[model samples]
Structure formats: structure tokens, C-alpha cells
Target: MKNEIIIFSGIEPGKKGAGNLVYFFLDRLKINYVEFKLHFNKTPDGFLIRQLKNFVPRNLSKSLYYSFYRFFFKSSENIINRKVILFHPQSIGLELSINLIRNNFVYIYVFDNFLFCRKSYNYIDRNKSCLLCLKDKDAYLKYKCDFFPVKHNPHKYDDFLLTISNNLSRVHFLTQNRNQSNLLYQKFGPIPNLTQIGMMVDMEDVVFNGKKTVKKYDFLYHNTLIEAKGIFYFLSIAKLLRNYSFIVPFSLKEVRNLIPDFEDFENVDFLSIKWNTGLKEILINCQVVINPSLWSAPVEGALLKSIKFNGCVAVVTTEYSFQSEIPSNVVIKLPDNLVEASKILNDVIDSEKIRINYKNEAKKWFDLYSKDIDISFDKFIQEEFN
Candidate 1:
């Protein structure tokens, strides 16, 4: 029987990391597949929906908006013998689409433990996981925890998630690592089926380049500078280290919107993420990359990329267990305490010994992880039959 694999998601081109990883691997798999992108902004009535977003009641607005999408853009019924791989269908009226994935052939991949969180950051009580949403349905609203899926309709979001979680138990899953697995188990009492698949990280092209030698920025933390992402922590470190420079990849416009206070800081520069080669060049020259998130990261692409570049990675204790999957010495585990993490980072600045050792250990770690990455897809496919 010919199999049809559909990778469904809600993506904004290059924005979501999970979407990017899923698309890359599905293409590499070279199978009979369909890429059904769920773009909310471009939907037929999207403009009208936005025009009326504020006027309409929150839950009613979400229901009308997503119900329109569910009615218009539907799951293709062509594949009788096929499998579905869902990244994040939360945006596509998940409340209405639950039945679309009710079959026995579906496989769901949970990239983020957002299910555990009152918010997508997977934290409620600053820098820590809060399970209040599990008990109090109003906890999401109480904390003002805005999320990508069901942002306007969180009550419905809770209902859909409970249903999705129940459905998720019916299929085989692709778990990232031991650390994430434990976290998911903690959040979700117990699961019936799981296959631990390592993240698909390829960085040989960006890692090794003899031509790129100019280190324009002293440090780089190129991600959406949100509070949950420890943006304030990075800024706090920059405030102390006045001598060194730091780059946060955000547009001049974004800087004004996201961190207006930090715009004047001489040590920090927020550059717009460009579509051109400039982005890669800027990434190559950074002395170190840091992911100072206080919350647990299931699939840490940033830290992995830093290791791939043979550069240094500074992180907090939340990443300790995830770091073990790499077995690399390049990772400089920072303390969760804001003051202490900065102090350790201060010592790391301009330390030639630290840089050299990190690059060396990264090479050893890359050799091991790359080999496993090569076969992860085959393992994922095999899980279906076995």
C-alpha cells in the first residue's frame, strides 16, 4: 500500500523552529507527502475576522474565526492508507479538528511541553513550571499567560488540549530526550507509547568556515527577546559587562517595541533578522551564544547550534539534563540565579583557555550526535510498524 504522510502546522515561513525542523526532515525523507500549511492571516475571511476581533466576544471570536478555517481548509481525504504527523495544529481550530486525527495511524510530535504550562513558555511562576492550569481553568487568564494557540480563547484551549491529550495517548510519539520525557510524564500522569527521537541538528556548513574571522559582536543571543526567554537576564548581564558588546537579533522597530529601555544601552544592539547572507555572517563571528532560559527547553536548537559552530554556549541549570544528551564539554552551565550566572559569564569573557577547550569538546560531541541524527527519521518511520 502506498503511504501518504502529511506534515500539518501553523507556521510563518522561517519563524517557528519546530515547523522548520519538521519541514526539513520530511523533505529529506523523500516520501510521498503533502505540506498543508495553515496560515491564519491569509485565510479567506481573515481580514474581516481581524476587523471584528476586538468587537466580538473572546470565545465567540475564536470559535467563528477557527470554525471558518476548519470549514474551508480541511484535512485531505485522499489517503486511505496513510499517516499524519502534526507539529502544532492549535492554530487551525484544534477544537474542530480533533476528529481529523482520531484514527490509529496518526503520530503526534510534542516539541514543546506547552501542555504543562499555563502558557507556552511552560512557566507560570516566573522561571518555574506552574501546574495551576491543570487544576484551575482560569489560571491562564489569572497569570495573563498569552499563548500562540487559542490566545483569545484560552478556556476553549484548555478543553481542546484535554481532548488532544486524550487523543495523543492513542498514537506513537516522538519524544526528544530523557529530560523532556520526564517533564512530560510529570505533567501528563502516564503515557502508553513513546519513542525517544533526538532532534535533527545539521551544522557542518555553519560550524566550519575558515573565511569568517571577524568577531563583530562579543556575544549573540539571536532569538525572540521575550521575558520568558530570559531577555531581561541577558540585558542584566550586558548592563554589568559594559566593556563587552552583545547582539540581540531584533529590528530597530522591534527593539522599540520589545525593549525600549535597552535601546539606549551602548553594550546591546538589536539587529533585524534579514533574509540575506548577513544573518549567517553575523552568527559565524560571535564569540559565544547563550540560551539563558530559566525554564526547561525540550529541544534546544540554539545551544546545539552554538556547539555546532565550535563556539561556546552559556546556559542555566534548567538545561543540565538536556545537555547530557550531547555529552559535550563545550556547554558552560550557568547558574539559575541571575547574579551568579552573570558572574560566571564575566569570568568567561576573553578567556582564551575557555574558548579553545569549548571548540575542542564541541568537535567530539558533534561527531557523536551527527551519526545518530542520520538515522532518526528511519527510526521514526519504523515505530509505525513495530
Candidate 2:
């Protein structure tokens, strides 16, 4: 009998964000599988219930939750010897509290610096994703380190690690998380079963629709306007570049309240991109799209779409996930300090030839890093088959 595949994620399947990419991969494979979400619930899996886990006897809450979930939602598909796949459980500040797989193959997907960066931002002080945890003993206390213990002391990391290392006719597998994998090496010396794979997005979703791609603005930064996202860096640069218009998703009035200095800059514009198509249109129309994230994002849908639009330069920090393997000419790296970043933006705004050249590099970047989704799923299918 073929090995059955069960996907476990806290991210809701029908959602439109990063987590949904896993769903898209499953759809492309035409493979039958079952999905169980850890979040998006109000009853047994709600916040109160999760908080209650801390008080319950160790291992009890985990077992109870799994038993209840399995009994209620086990796959109707009749394949034997199941392979359970987990993705970004730690992302939403939730943990399964157990990796205790009794009689099945387990596969885990890692996207962020979950173990090292408590906030999952994947960065340290210098706008860089420095692996401080491996070096600094006080790092966890410094960064608060990880989303485990959904409530507090609900599950121990030692127990989780032991479960993965232990086996009784069962196998534990993993997807490539370059950033985390690098840390794992420094922590445990070296792990034998590690593989690093670059993120891939569906090309059709981001492909141009034959409309003229005239860039309306000089710079664009959206998503969470938090310090971790490097929004403050973008804001500082925006202030320095007077001729260029900077756009975001929040109202201009609200932004002034958030950062009063930006009030005087008439070049700033605000329009919330709530829908996927709207975001795509914005990226398609913009001259440059930047995350400028302090976190080393393994994959970004916005970056993928902007490249598809053919005129957008993906400006980002010099982190492994974003800058690794991608050609230097295709994706430009963000400067470490505000002064340098502002100077670079000023140059981009002033030079027409430079903007035209960088814009032309978008297609090359897209084709190299994110042209196909099939290759990614193919590896999963092969792993299951083997």
C-alpha cells in the first residue's frame, strides 16, 4: 500500500498568505491528502483551551488534543502507513507540544528562524540575521527566543528534541530551512539529514497580463509596519528622498500619528492592499517593491509577483533566504544604516538609466529563482515514494 500523507499546519487552508503556498503545492501534485489546522478554531482548539494546556499534566493536553483531532478528522482516503507533514507550527505562537509520532513517517517544513528568533523576525541589532544564540548564552533571554510553550512550560524543548532523535520503525524528515539549518550546525556541530532548498512560487499567479508597466512611484514598502519589517528604515529613506513618492497601505493621517515627522512629506501616499489582486496590481504598477525586512524571509509572495510584473526591483536586506543564490544584479540589498540607505534611494530616484536597467533585471530574477512550483512538489513526492 502507498504511504498516506497527512498535512498539519496552524495556518488555515483557505487563507491567502504565505502559509497557503503549502496548499498550492499540494494542489499542483494532484495527490490525495488530509489537512488538519492548529489555528482557526473557537472550541476545543481555541485560545482558552491552549492556555489551559499549561495547567494540565505534562503530555496530557497534547495527547488529548491529538486523539480528539485524529478521531474527528482522520483521512477518508484508505492508503496505509501514513506520512505526516508539519509546516510552520511555531509561526502563530502555537506548538503541538509533542513530536511523538508512534507509527508513521513525519516531515517538517521550516520557513523562519523559529528556534533562534523568538519573534520569528530572524534578525539581530545591525539589521542582520546574526546567529547570536549559537554564540551568546544569554541570547534566548535577550531575544525571548521562539514561540514554543503556547501558554508557558506546556511542552519542554528537550522532550521535543528527544522525540525527533528517537525511532522505532518510524522516520522523521525535514524541508530545507537554510537559516535555521545553519544555526542547527553551530548548535549540534553538524546534522547528517539536512537539505537546503530555495522557495518557489507559481509563475501563473504573478505573470504579466500584457498591460503597460509604467512605474508610478520611486519606492513602495508594505506589510506589517513594525520595527522587525524595517519599516522605520524605509521611512527614514523616504524622508531623505524628496523627489520620490513612497506608498504604503495605511492612511496618511494614521501614518502621521504613528510617525509625526512624515506628516510634512507630501510624497507619501497610503492605500491598504487587503486583497491579493490589489497587492498584485500595486506591485505590477510600482517601480520598486521592497520588504526591507530585518527578518531573513525564506520566500515572499510580493517579491515573486513584483518580479513577474517586469518593472519592479526587489530591494531587500542581505539575508540568506532573500539574497542567497539570487543574482546580485537581480535583487538589490538594503544598506545597514539609514544614512546609506537614504543615499542609495536618492541615487535611484535621480538616475533614470539606473532605474531602467534595474527594472529590466526583474524577469531574469523571476526565471532563475521562482519560475516553477513543480520542482518543489516533485521532491516531496519522491521523498514519500522512497
Candidate 3:
């Protein structure tokens, strides 16, 4: 008998980061898995409909679509025999699918935490204003009004919860300012059987180029100009380092809308490139990469990619800790303040030996992680899921 595992994530294929990670790992493992694409109506009127759905009678819209979707894409009876993992439950429609198949397999809820936090930098929040959608009906109305999923408790349907690390669990607990682990212990009362996994990076693409001449800059920042990414903080740093060049991967148009008079940065030169095509290229050509997210995951891909491409990375100070999966020479933890961060950037860029040492360290780290993916997957299955 062949063991089968079917994983479901709401993300579309070919996208970068999490979706790409999922696709790569599943393929590397040779796991029997099928990716389902979730589609939403893309139109100006769709936005209006989404707004109306948020504030109107929940049952009216939910019953209509729920029935239609179920009738069209009913769960296969054979699915009961396959082990299943549900990636994220933030999407209401996807939650419905989970409900339909809850009893058939091992139900795993992969928690990214930002899924529940209303103040996420990513535009993943369906209810923008409600902090209590999961607890109070009145709070749900204040934000979601009458969304169908809001009428039904989707969180209750999840059987097992998974997180990327202890830090991720801490964020989830901090989001509510409540000890979620203890809360889970109170409700479920002990689930030693539940599996907690760490997010894995594919180190195959990382190659160390020793002591390459780095572009001189006091500080470096990369990310969209959205407020949550704290692009303004970068802009301020750019002003301080009049000689430093700030490379931003946004079109003049997007920058204008996302930041007020963004072109006004005296020393900053905009490098117009979409993240999809230009992120790696930009990192390869820069000196230091700064990730100053007030609250975010370790941002492993960008950090590892920068080191691999012969650039140093400086992440902001935060309680959220990540294991240094990169070479020490290439990765620097920036102080919470931009001034201190700038000094660190200056010190590292001027030292060639530091760069060379980091490059060698990075090569070793990449080789270890790039060990046969099939063997890793087999071990993961036997130890983690079995």
C-alpha cells in the first residue's frame, strides 16, 4: 500500500516565497500532492461586492455561494483515505473546504500568525478593524458586519495546529497579548501528538563569492514602500548618508502613491524593478541588505539570497529571534535605531577579510542544507508525520 499525503494551500503556484517553498519541497519529496488554485473575481465591481459582503447579512451571501461551490466541487470520497494538511485558514472559502473534509484525514492548521492579526503589513486581513472577530459577535459586526464565515466559527474545525517555530508561536501569543500555548493547553488540554515544524530554506541557490568589491553605502533597505515595511525609516537613513545610494525596486508610480513625494529623497536613486524578476539581481549588485520589519518572520529567503550573492544583510532588532542559518560574515543584526545600523553597515563594507570569512561560512551552511532533498523528505515523513 502506498502512503499518500494531500496538502492544500490557498496560494497560487509560481508565486515567490511561501508558495514557491511549498511547490519546491513537495516536488523534492516526490510526495503525491495536488495544488488547488483559489480564484477570486477580479473586477472593480468585485471590490464593491467584497465591501458589501463585509457589512451585510452574512447568511444571505454565504448560503448562495456555499451551496453553489459545494455542488460544483464536492470533496472526493477517496480523499478520506489520504493524509491531509491545510496550510492556512484565513480564507473563508478555503475554510469551507476544510469543513467539508475535516473528518477524512489528519487535519493540520499551519499558522503564520499574521493570518489572525488585524494589523499585519501584508493585506491579508479580511476584517480590517475588528480585533475580536473570533470571540465576540459584536466585534465581528464592527468589522466584518455579516460575512458568512463570520457567522460560522471556522477556528473550531481545525484539528491540529502547526507553526514555523517557537518565535512564530510567540507572535501569535503576543498578537492577542495572551499566552496562546497555554490557551491551547486549556482548551485541548495537551496535544503532545501535534507536530511543530520549522520553516526550511532551500540552500541550493546560495553560492559564496569571496570578498567582492561592495558598493559603498552607509545603510541599505529593500522592500515595498508600504507603511508597514517602514520605508520612511529607510528614507530618513538615506538622508543621513548623503553619499549612500538607496536602491528601491518600485516604479515611480507605485512609490508616489505609497509614499508622499517619494522621489524627493536627495541621495536615493530609484531602481525600477518588480520584485518577481528583480529581487535577486538587485541584491547581487548591492552592498548591504536591510530588513527593518517591526514585526515579521525571519525573512530567510532574502537574507540567504543576499549572502549567497555576495551581499551582507542587516535585520532590525526585535524580540523575534531567528537562528543564524547564514554565514556570520554576511549577516549583521542592526540596532533598532537607524544610526547604529548605518555604522554597522559602514564597518562591514570596509572590511574585506570579514566579507571573505562570511563567504566561506555561507558555502558550508548551504551545502549542509542542500543535502539530498529526497532523503530529507523521507526523514521528515517518517519522523514528523508518521
Which numbered prediction scores highest in TM-score against the true structure? 1
1 or 2: which has the higher lDDT? 1
For model 3, the superposed segments whose C-alpha errors exceed 4 Å read 1-3, 31-82, 92-94, 97-101, 107-111, 119-190, 194-197, 200-220, 224-226, 261-263, 275-278, 296-299, 323-330, 370-376, 383-386
TM-scores of the models, in the order given: 0.79, 0.73, 0.63
In model 2, state the lDDT of residue 177: 44
Per-prediction CA RMSD (Å): 5.4, 7.2, 9.0
Question: What's the best-to-worst order under TM-score?
Answer: 1, 2, 3
* Order of candidate numbers by lDDT, starting with the best: 1, 2, 3
lDDT of 3 by residue, 96-125 (tens): 444434434434343333333333222223
- Residues 289-319, candidate 2, lDDT per residue (tens digit)? 7767666666665566555664546465555
Q: List the residue pairs that clash in candidate 2.
A: 118-146
lDDT to native, each model: 0.61, 0.55, 0.46
Model 2, poorest ten-residue lDDT window? 34-43
Model 1, residue 377: C-alpha shift (Å): 2.2
